[model samples]
Target: MKNFIHDDFLLETDHAKELYHDYAKNQPIIDYHSHLSPKELAGNRVFENMTQLWIDGDHYKWRAMRALGIPEKYITGEAPDSEKFNKWAETVPYALRNPLYHWTHLELNRYFGIGDLLTPKTAGKIYEECNAKLGLEDYSARGLIHRMNVEVVCTTDNPLDSLDHHRDLAESGWPVKVLPTFRPDGLITIEGAAFIDYLSSLSKITNIKIIDFETLGQAIKKRVEYFHKNGCRLSDHGLPHAYAMDFTEAEINNILSERLQGGTISKKEVAQYKSAVLGLLGGLYTEKNWTMQLHLGPIRNTNEVILSKVGFNAGVDSIGDFQQAEQLAGLLNGLNNKGHLPKTVLYNSNPNDNELFATMAGNFNGDGIKGKVQFGAAWWFLDQMDGITNQLNALSNMGLLSCSVGMLTDSRSFLSFPRHEYYRRILCNLLGKDIKAGLLPNDMEWIGKIVRDITYNNAKDFFQFPSYVEKAPLENG
Candidate 1:
């Protein structure tokens, strides 16, 4: 029988095959955004088993298992690694059209070279095979990344993080660039129960005792400069929506002071404070020429019961219906007006806002840059096949698709790099389908180059990362 995944798996036409194989496949990956642990990369840590590497901390698979009524013990509880892998394998066959099905199998095939379909019957055999290979030298943490042809991995970090792991990786001079992305959601969010606690942590890290909003800015600016000195070039924010309301320094400072002193602030006060913080951080990013990423529109941690048990980002989050256009445009325009809008990437989890985001991206393009403002890659629940396709279609219709800094894993798994491969196949298929329908011309070479540019070149120029040449494995001096 033929394999389920093959050379031309998602490519439905000859033109698609040509674009993927000839132009896109071999291009190096610039995973500019991910939640991968910098410590793992720094230590080149090796997993004890397949479950540790594959199933553990994988909320994607956990959600699928839960959908099938699998108990939490088998998912995230203290079930044996074998049992967890077994439950995941069982969940796979039932996951049919879900993106998890494709991602599960793709990671299996890519990492272990196992072509066998995952099922309850084959789970044990496949699990053992994968664990055996995990014992290999090439299956080590950095080795896994090395095999994936990733050039840069920018991990999300808070302003107060030491970034010791990123610093360690950079100093080690591994061929793959492991960099930090300044993600200050904790800082931006002032309404959370832990906001004051987070402020204390930031103060401890920066030693700039925060008495008010202006002092908070000074502390965060110190951290941003610290990150810039340590080679950070990007900042990422996860907000329900943009907080670009009108506010003065005094108003924000007063609200922050009250909050800092354990006094509750009103909702409007929170918005004004968040807006001020975003604007302050935007100016810092602008000074360092760093890219700023806004991941908006997710009503996170809605399941209070599950949230209480599992903490946040445990897959209970869902797409939100927040108004994107006015708030987004307001924030971007405010920054642009102040010449503080660094290159920005906008992402909304709600599919309803695709064109809204795409057109908003077009509204801020200038400074001779190719894509100064980007309708960023599909994110969170939207990082699947259909979500990716819809995003590309929206961008193609509303903006210059060629200038798009295409596809990011936005994932926590090293194996998730294949999502980039999946994206390239989808991109090629879309263009090829267009050509087949006589919408685009029959020019292969030009179209092929566009594929390559989206796959790597656009990100290369867009990020302005330090030069990298993948070399041999690390050896003792």
Candidate 2:
């Protein structure tokens, strides 16, 4: 019997197979957005076992194991690494039709040369086989990145972070451009538990006491320059919804003063304050030519009972039914009117907002930048096959899909790079089926270039990494 994953895996037609093999298969990856660890890459850390490499810090697996009624000890508690791997293998058979099933096999085949489907029956041998090779020099953190032909990896970073690891990697000359993305969600979120302390660290780092709104912008401006000097060209935000409520600068200042004084703030006041801060940051981003990524619509920690055990970011978040279009259009329009709108990518966690986001992106594209406001890759819960297809279809129907910046892992795992391949296959299949249906022309040369461009070129130019990108040596190939 043939392996479940093969050259023709998701490709459904001859044209699809040719397009993937000829154009998209081997393009170098530009992971412009991800949650990967800069410290691991800097140190070239080696995995001691399969669980550490796959299960630890992966809430996807944790959620799956919990669904299988596996105890918390096996999922995230004090279970041994070997036992964790065993629990994950047992849950694999139950994960059918889930993205995790495909991702598990893809990572296994790409990284460890294991092709058998993961299940309880095959768990022990596969685990031992993977653990044996993970300690090899070629399986180190940097090695995994290079092995996947990654050209640039931009990691999400907090504003208060020193980015010393990025500096170390750049000077270490490791070839993969390990860069940082400015993520100031904490800075904008005034109601967060750690808001005051986070600002204190920001003030200390920039040496500008953030006593109020003006000083806060100044300190943030200094950090933007700091990041730009360190080769950062991207910024990211994670919010429940767009904050575009109208408010005067004085109101914002008063709100900041209220928060600083341990006074209460109303929900409307919070919205106004965040809107004011977002507008302020937009100008800062445009000044530095940064791409601001807004990842909206996640009602986090919905499972308070699960939260008690997982602390946070343990995969308990779900899609929020927040009002998106009006607030989002307001935010983008406010930025555009002020001439402070930088290149921006809009990501919506709720699938219902796909077309809304696609059409909204077109409203700001006349500023001489191609695909200025992007409908970013399907995100979080929506990164699977159906989500990817629907997102692409919406962009193709309402916006220019050809100039797309294309797929990103948006993942924290090193082995998740094959998701790019997963996306490419689905993309090619879409075009191929269209061609076979006579909906598109039989011009492989033209369509193939589109495939190649979407897979790699657009991202390289979109982020403009020419300034800091360092290519890995051919010997590493």
Query: How close is each model in CA RMSD to the real structure?
Result: 3.6, 3.7
lDDT of 2 by residue, 1-477 (tens): 889988899999998998999989999999999999999988889989989889998988888888889999998889999999999999999999899999999999999888899988999999999888988888999898899999899999988777778888988878889888999989988987788888888877778988889999999988887787778899999998888999988898899998988888999999999999899999999998899999999999988888998788887988999999899999999999999999999998999999999999999886778888999999989899999999999999999999899999998898999999999999999999999999999999999999999999998888886466343221201
Q: Write one digit per residue (lDDT tens) for candidate 1, span 48-92.
A: 998899888888888889999999989888999889889888889
* Model 2 TM-score (2 dp): 0.97
- Index of the highest-lDDT prediction: 2
Q: Against the hidden true structure, what lDDT does model 2 obtain?
A: 0.89
Where model 2 places Cα greater than 4 Å from the true spot, the runs are 469-477
Q: Report residue 319 deviation for candidate 1 (angstroms).
A: 0.6
Candidate 2: which pairs clash? none
In angstroms, give how far residue 32 of model 1 lies from its true place: 0.5
lDDT values, one for every candidate: 0.88, 0.89
| Per-model TM-score on C-alpha atoms | 0.97, 0.97
Model 1 scores a TM of 0.97
